[model samples]
Target: MAVFRSRFARVLAVIGLAAAMLVGVFVGTASACSCLPGGEGAKYARATHVFTGVVVGRALLSGDPDTAHDDKYRYLVLNYRNHKGSAPALVGVETAVGGATCGIELALWSSYVVFAQGDASDGVVETTLCSGTRLASGGPPVTEEPPTTTTPRPTALGGSSPACPPIA
Candidate 1:
């Protein structure tokens, strides 16, 4: 009986440690991506822009080109206005059908549409290749709003740009 009890305690200890480690990893990952430089997730949470760009490519499966992965996966490349306003920067977003995948691996993008949520640091943003239905028929119009006192502030850590610069 004593040996059985000891073994049970050991098993419980291992399980507890494993659970704690899993939680730590999750929290760390969330923090890293929360305000990732050039990541749209953080921008989306801030609600800076209502509509951004248009989707240009068809949704493709992760690995198999022959299969249509629209139901399983969705991705878009967005042409967004940059700070200079000289041209639009293209941002890419690849998201799971559901909000299951969240991490640095997924949040990193070349170009993407950034939507302001509320708080830039803590809010969550949805990054995509294009703005999807958010944009007008001809894409987001060029209209400049006067700099407002309530404008979403720029990211302190230089996150205003995309994770990867547009290739073109």
Candidate 2:
């Protein structure tokens, strides 16, 4: 009877260990890089900088594969296909390499459709594979989006001083 109890205790310990390992495996995969899963249009809407450019430079700042952005790659682009916000013709992108940190290995001198997030306060351009930034297979687009658009003010029925636009 004592031997039976001892055997049962060992079995329970083994089961618990197995369960813990299974949970760890599931959690690791789940917590790993998960991009904004959506189509091109959805990614475009979220991106602050969307343009095609040639990568002119790449410098590895850190050897760590787990780093968010350890490499600084510069791009030279003239055309802005879709620029939601203002950016220089030449932009510096900080990114990582390998899928471990959700970074894509961007080749030097290769053209890419750079979808980035520009920090206005600090003035930095950040790009990642998760941002849908990919290589431009052919080249930059032939035409660009229209430079500007003006929002016309709604006129009041009888107004000397212009009132703010109505909420409705």
Candidate 3:
């Protein structure tokens, strides 16, 4: 009787541990999904103007391989040049595509799109705004040459000279 009782207690402890682990896994997954804009049903709302920046990193693709069809999705890290004069800032977003295959078709670094805009605070641009299908399968678009300007001599000896001063 004593041995049987000990075995029962051990089983109960194992069950409790398993339940705790399951709960932890669920919570972690829920938090990650929630971090995405629009919760689970987020979709593109309207078109908006957005400045383009260079792709500073490679795209990441993920999805289940055991499905009937091997489905995959893409995510990109963009370095957006906030204002006309500021340095580029790094931003990451999940590439929105109808199916896994479409996501794979989109180009990485060299490609630019008018993606559906999202809240600026989150730094995520929804896939909806990605307009102007992929460009040629090569480098990024040609950017206009920055206007040239002549520098003025320093007014005082000890003062710092302005670099890339505004064009008159």
Candidate 4:
């Protein structure tokens, strides 16, 4: 009876240790994509291109044709400013294929307010879930006010820069 109790105690201890290790592993893993807290205004300041448009089309592009995993999703934007802009009418926006990389999945034919950043190395305009892009249905009502420049403000770390552009 004493031996049985000892074995049972060991088993319970092992199970508890395993559960603790699993929880630790999961908690550490989930810290991969950490975003700082900010509002849409802050997101607008970080973005290079801001537009409201619908996803007219989507396609997967592969760096190597022989590879099975296509790299990213290329979305075609249209139906805005009478389908005209200083940028192309049909702009191709690239995003990672999964949310694990802070990627966004824009539904075809659905409109969204996109806050995109220009990739300096590749020169491609891209957006992510962290960029404050949202469905147009839930976005702020469109106003005709032009963007007004505000006094530059210091960042949390104590550097000054221009304020966010007003949402159109």
TM-score list, all predictions: 0.26, 0.53, 0.33, 0.56
RMSD, candidate 1, Å: 16.4
Off by over 4 Å in 1: 29-168
Cα lDDT of model 4 by residue, 74-142, tens digit: 888873632112344567888877777677899999998777777424434788778877888876523
Better of 2 and 3 by TM-score: 2
How do the residues 38-69 of candidate 3 rate in per-residue lDDT, one tens digit apiece?
Answer: 31112212323233454545454545655433
Which candidate number has the best lDDT? 4
lDDT of 2 by residue, 34-93 (tens): 786666666777778777777776665555677434444443344335446665666677
Top model number, TM-score: 4
lDDT of 1 by residue, 7-52 (tens): 9999999999999999988775231112344323333333444444
Q: Give all candidate RMSDs, comma-separated.
A: 16.4, 9.9, 16.6, 9.7
* Candidate 1, residue 125: lDDT: 30
Candidate 3 TM-score over all chains jointly: 0.33
| Model 3 spans with C-alpha error above 4 angstroms | 1-45, 59-74, 80-88, 96-104, 128-130, 133-168
lDDT of 4: 0.71
The worst-scoring run of ten residues by lDDT in candidate 2 lies at 140-149
- Candidate 1 structure lDDT: 0.40
